[model samples]
Target: MPEETAKQTHFYSVEAPDGSYDLRIEEMLARIESTAAPIYMRLINGKIPEHQDKMDMAQFLAVMVVRTPGSRKDAAEMVGRMIQIRNYATGVHDRAFNSLVHRIEQGEGRQLTEESRTSLRRSLIDPSGYRLELGKEWALQHLTAADKLTPVLFQMRWRTIGAAQGFFITSDDPVVRWVEPKTWHPIYGDHGYLNKTAVVTFPLTPKVMLAMSWEDEGANAFAGRQGVDRLNRLRALQADEYLYAHLDHEVIRRMAVATKGSRPRMTTEGFGPKKFAATTLRRGRANRPS
Candidate 1:
């Protein structure tokens, strides 16, 4: 367990007995089905998020592929067009930085010191929110200058968290600063990453039970359906324990059976940080700033 927080969390190891786990997963499934928000209500899942099982854990990373519009019929031409547009945007933004600095110096009635000038330049290049997707090799393989669909690539970092409030896990960045990294990392490769093997985790918070399926293929892998969900919270356990001991625990039973398979992960890096398999990506709903 990561350092105990004010909210003390108990550990639930995947290596524990399978017989006991079956019944426990059932109870968790029952709790979530009756309490979690519906799929049509996903817009609000960000606030309350979704509940997850104790073992619903894996490290996730992602990148994007965007199709572009053109008639030149060559991959290079398509890439060139994108570069032109990006450069134009960068130039415009750089000018705005100069203007802001000019105003600050004028308003203060003093020229910017050398150190201040360096700081201003650094701030101009820092990522505003999430970093822009920048891989062109993958894009070139799927596109040509003649293709009208332009795919842009944005990479997502592998994130760890204490508890899953919902269906997705936010990265260890400035955005979701509350999540803590806790896991048994047998998968860490020589590069010191969790991208090598599948990991099971014990989330401190409850997680929703949802099914994920692919709706598109190839460059359209990002498209998928987020199924309905259920939660497994400590409070839910208490409420249901007394009410109905055996009243329809099928939902949870089914979920436990399904989870024994491989974890669903999303990433552009095929196989993993080390090519564990010849594959790439998983399905989930991720938020991006408009």
Candidate 2:
């Protein structure tokens, strides 16, 4: 709905007989924004959020995490991967195809003609090349997952970093999950959102950003030039396609150049974003650059 490009498209839309899909999600998002607007204004005005504000903000962040194009594409890719695995399952694919061929022959009370059999065989094998379309169920699954993740995010220590000199930029996939490289394992593969060292960052505004971590110390602080630049770089790399900022600055241009080809991409063929690994100081105070 945010006009980044000339194209306009619907959000959270799905085909349903009762029209509940669009109505329900639209109403829910409306309510969330209605409650969150005050908190957003408070933050922009440099006021610390109260307990209720944090709760509402947490839910908003959780929904944002699941409601983006990147997230939906990721879900679609997962569905495609599951289908691919099922199609290529050991012995199962062949057995199923053969069984279908046999059933066609039996149902017609005669062997299938060569042309008919060939067509059937091709149809059976075609799924291997097909990518599964994510249905309404995927939306439900992501919303449920976000519901579970909200409490965990709320429990983490939160701090707001104001960009004093430089400004912060956001992207299509603005919420970034950074896994501490020291604790990262290739086998595990970026699998820790609840981990003590995991850092989740969201840009509240060009001048303010929010950070959640278990090991960080500051509750509220200002980011120096280096800190703002580092966070902006992470955002640029995390973006799927579009980046948003108040101004078209040289810093943003530099970020585009510095993080070229690093934007996380999700494909229909089950390929996902390349894993991003880096270390950033939490609140620019707890960990100092050497």
Candidate 3:
């Protein structure tokens, strides 16, 4: 894949001196809501020229909900759901573009004329530049993860889920096992794995948080404070069992401070009934990749 274009932008930090959490929330909410309105209108009017407008709306809402002060835990959960929706929307856009190109090719009954092909390619790729720049700005402004400990804690949750589920849930591999088999007492023997067994099967909510945190911190820290590079170092340190165990306690403490009063709520149901497995099996039988 081609490297994504370089982003040029900056996000102002919002630090209210009174330390009143509600005030902070209200300010951020106002900013997001105000920014989102015009974008939403543009989308509704069909005046925006690209899919980036749609993505900007999704991302803006995600930031707004996550930054809203209620329960940090709830906000985190909401952010996770938002990320999943954004990922799904991006996938749908890609499929639609591909389908359009395929139909055009079919209609032509031959390869596309060079000029036509160039136009189609430009139509598909040009808009991503603006979207990525906007996304970077939003992430820097509102998607911060509190502090350094937050990323480690987020990673812990991911690791725990993967361990309990018995396969790497966030890997890009398509054939990894995701769900484990168990007999529910109520069912008296009914058992099967839950979601598709594959890397990248689920949205990388924790990773997104960590990445955002890194960006925020990197942007804010003083020169020589070691910024996002510091995050990379922490990840390396986490590989050491003693280091990780020691830091885990710190992460829990910080999360308590950050997430205070928020309880884990299931944002959405996990992928239902392993339908993807059947599709994958069929593709295999047909000697095709899913």
The local distance difference test score of each candidate is 0.28, 0.68, 0.32
**Model 1 misses residue 236 by how many Å?**
24
In candidate 3, what are the lDDT values of residues 216-261, reduced to their tens digit?
1222112122332333233322221111221334443453344333
C-alpha lDDT of residue 142 in model 2: 65
Among the numbered candidates, top lDDT falls to 2
lDDT of 2 by residue, 1-290 (tens): 56675663335544455543445766787898889888878877667666888888888888888877667666655554454444334223567767767876788899878788666555333444433444544544566567877787778788788998889999998888887788876465556677778889899888988888888666688989999988988888878777888998986987787776686554333332122121111111121111
Task: Return whichever of 1 and 3 wins on lDDT.
Answer: 3
lDDT at residue 175 of model 3 (Cα atoms): 13
TM-score of each: 0.20, 0.77, 0.20
**Top-down TM-score ranking:** 2, 3, 1
For model 3, where is the 10-residue window of minimal lDDT?
276-285
Question: For candidate 1, what is the TM-score?
Answer: 0.20
- lDDT, candidate 1, 1-290, per-residue tens: 45764551111111123322223423443444343324213422322222341112110101011122111112333343343334334434767657767878999999998799766555334323222332323233442321221111011112222122223221111011111135333365222122222222212222322211112112211111232132222212212112112234564445434543222122232221121122111112122211
